[model samples]
Target: MSNELYTVIPDGSVTTPRGFRAGGLHCGLKKTGRNDLGAVVSDVPAAAAGVYTTNVFQAAPLHVTRESIGKEGKLQVMIVNSGNANACTGEQGMEDARSMRDAAARAFGVAPHLVGVTSTGVIGELLPMDKVLSGIERLPAAVSGTREGSEEFCQAILTTDLVKKEACVSLTVDGIEVHIAGAAKGSGMIHPNMATMLGFITTDAAIDAEALQSLLREATEVSFNMITVDGDTSTNDMVVAMANGLAGNEPLHPGHADWPRFAQAFVYICRELAKSIARDGEGATKLIEVQVEGAVSDEAARVIAKTVIGSSLVKSAAFGADANWGRIIAAIGRAGQPVNPDTVDIRIGEIVTLQQSRPVPFDEEQATEYLKGDTVEIHIHLHQGDGRATAWGCDLTYEYVRINAAYRT
Candidate 1:
């Protein structure tokens, strides 16, 4: 949690890490001329770890990625396409996903088992393989080990997102400078069980595949898994991480001396990316953060925090700049977490609207003004234990409705 161990790289991206190159291109996946296909290629086989959506109708690309990474716990190239979610297309979809993987392998000169693939956009439709394969053929030429390449790749993964989400940091591990960077995109259908949307993390640290997998899973629990937008988990949500071990440091694990610093930086990057996704929620005007403390356990606190932040009533209230403590309390109650009603406290910014579950008359105008800001913070104290957690969301607004009403068109 301390900033002393790492430095934030200004305008950093996936290519910021050593031995990584990224790029994106337009392949006619979308009606507009925006880049719809992208790739992040590691110079060598990199230890890989991934977490995918829990939605039953998982995308075909997710299965392909899992097979590639599960074989040897490493990946050399990761291909992604936007504007087509490659889900629910039956056996043809499976074949298409493998075809994409094969194309990426051939283009990048890597084994098919060393390449992973992902897709996002419209669901339940077959991908236009003609265009997708053409994009894959030209993909290698588009890639470069530069910031511009990373930027382009980020842009290509976006669907309804208004802005790209990325985070990068450098920390010293075993006296070697290690860099870690991530890029993500998600504006809607973002309630995550493991992870939301398409996220990619690249690091140059020397970490074992098992250790990296464990660390990434832990980070997702408190970061991506804690945020919600519309409470609809997509069919093609996943976060994939590759560690190229180009830092030339000692192998990292739980017992490594600098593991704490590395883990801290990793979790920080994920949380920042997740918060960006929440802030950029489809047509959202304001970012709302809910902090729940003193629950029976950390899991309980997480559930309560997510419940409060995900509630439509709470989001609507935030959009209207209303000090609606009742909605917050109602959410907390339904969270199914143990809460001593009489000892619960609630606050919107510094305005205390509820104290020990008793109404505290506060200046409604001040509360409204605070909620009207670009960011809102809600604090709930249960006085039950030491467990605490935080969740992020965005206010419900008319623009959100208008954007989703005709999203497919």
Candidate 2:
């Protein structure tokens, strides 16, 4: 997606931006020896923005992060942990979250409100503060502006995820070069309206908190909010972004001449991260994409696309390499959106399985072969209007049930 206005950094991460450093270390949270605690810090206060899970039972760390960022619209450091969600533990959970923030602030020599904290993992468990504070005390010593540090940070924030999700891009902002990078961790308990994921973005662009917040929300609607692995939403989903104004570009706003370019690059990074999460879904062997076109509105198209991608029948059919157009059309019909049944068309790859709302007699062998690939695309045309949308998910397999059935054990 790189072009004249922007370029992609092949090897980029959260620490790729100016004035930032990150690292991670083991904290006895996970059963394995992998690092379970991490922190990303900036040399100076940076403008901050965040979008959180809409679940009524929000996690404790989310409240702590929101309070810190809402205080002054800035943050100097973000502390995170995995393997313990610290949710449904009542007041004790909130105290532990704030304690995590205070410990990071004390270690980094920053004010408490300038530190943000978040956590993920098994719900209804109390965080072991002894291990967490010890990890925080040693966190700063591990911090550095290097790829190794970024990789450690990424590794520390995983549970069921098999691969690290990261993206970076650069765009020119008024003759100044600005870089944006992000890292995310998510595998299951994923669906629209956010998922069981934690995303962090860093940039060197000079932007205010208000403008950055608006841009983050808009980008999320088309990226993170359009993907699902399972139909369950989690309590700890959050995406936060920070800009340190180190790029030396003029302050950016919605009216800036190059704002659109920067936004494009930002949205691209976010979409890449979101797609990676979908591709790496728990026990998933293939990624499934649903593209809807010619709807009454973009929102309607999005609804139809999500419905198709989230259908268990559709996912199972893809997993079995079956060209089941019936499941696809069934999902579209139940999406509760406007659609002209007589003018509908559906295709699996280049093979048209249905046209004008009727069977088209496609090659079963060819269609099955296409579905067996690592990625599959389902194209649907409503022929009702100019609206369009794309959604991503993954094929369901027996392995998925096996993994989740004994996850807590």
Candidate 3:
């Protein structure tokens, strides 16, 4: 929502003095000496809402934060670490995650429950607590409402990400200005039942817990839930939204007249952040948009869209810049949704690649050129009803395979 155009960078900063101070440090969790720990502390207790991976094998931080969110949609600080997922380490893993939250709460002088914790990296490994605690002790000094701090925070969130992801927008609602800024990190282990996504969104809007939760869920449904890179979800997937109420606007409620505008802003922020994740997907060279139209229902369309986007065959074709419509049709047939194959239509960009279960007469050169772009669109029409859905994905590349194969080594 800010007036600035989107820019690509390996490391960058974003600063919004709306009420939050953030810092990131190198706690030695990562072997590269890059910043791998981040802390976000609000000037005041903020309304918070979160959504975690549906995978039963959720990480300890997710389980603890889920309970905290249920108790109250509020938090004062968040601590995040990268390079070790801390998943499947049993009870000690949970304790270490709790200790991270507890240390942050103590450092910020807030209730332990008001501190949320998250980690990402290799699974089945214990977190390096000594380094994490040392980083926690330095959080206060690192905290700054400045561009340097923001850049550090963004850098601290990386794993296999080739570039840091950030989005921010400022909009005037009800005669008051509000700012929404967010940062996310994810490169591999991506799939829709939440993906490996880790997002932290900060807003200056005044909104209640219930409303914030509702908005975040709806926003994520259209954003994070509709993306896939590797079709593998992570145990540490989590997205959190925090509203510090720095904007003087009246508190937003579901029935309030300004609620729709506020919700739209939230959706925009989430969409931008989600798109950044896809663009920065592990070794991704292109961003793919899968658009499904005219399904039996919207839900069915979503299922089909995700299926097409997640198909390895389809993704591999995209990577090769091959305009293979058969893969798309094959994905649709096996999407587990009711579909009339005879009525399906598929297109790459504006070229109709398939029509009614057969290849349409179109120039392969044009389709290939479109596919070669940084952004690709795959459109499908079921011609059964007036329901539509769109999802985002990235092409599978050899670099992606290389990054993961050598990740643990």
User: Against the correct fold, how does model 3 do in TM-score?
Assistant: 0.95
Better of 2 and 3 by lDDT: 2
Q: Per-candidate TM vs. native? A: 0.99, 0.99, 0.95
Write down the lDDT that model 2 would get. 0.94
Tens digits of per-residue lDDT for model 3, 1-409: 1333222222323347377888899989988899989987788888999999988899999987876666677987888888988889899999998899888888889998888988988899898899899989888888788878888888887898888778776666677777777889887888887977799988888988898998889888888998899999888999988888889788888887778766776787788778888888898999999999999898899899999999999999999999988889999999999899688889899999788877789998988888899999999999999889888889999999888889888
- TM-score of candidate 2 against the unseen true structure: 0.99
Order of all candidates by lDDT, from best down to worst?
2, 1, 3
Q: Give the residue spans of candidate 1 off by over 4 A.
A: 194-196
What's the candidate order when arranged by decreasing TM-score? 2, 1, 3
**Where does candidate 2 stray beyond 4 Å?**
none
Per-residue CA lDDT of model 1 for 300-370, tens digit only, reads: 99999999999999999999999989999999999998999899999999999999899999998888899
Clashing pairs in 2: none
Measured on C-alpha atoms, candidate 1 has an lDDT of: 0.94
What are the clashing pairs of model 3? 1-169, 2-169
lDDT of each: 0.94, 0.94, 0.85
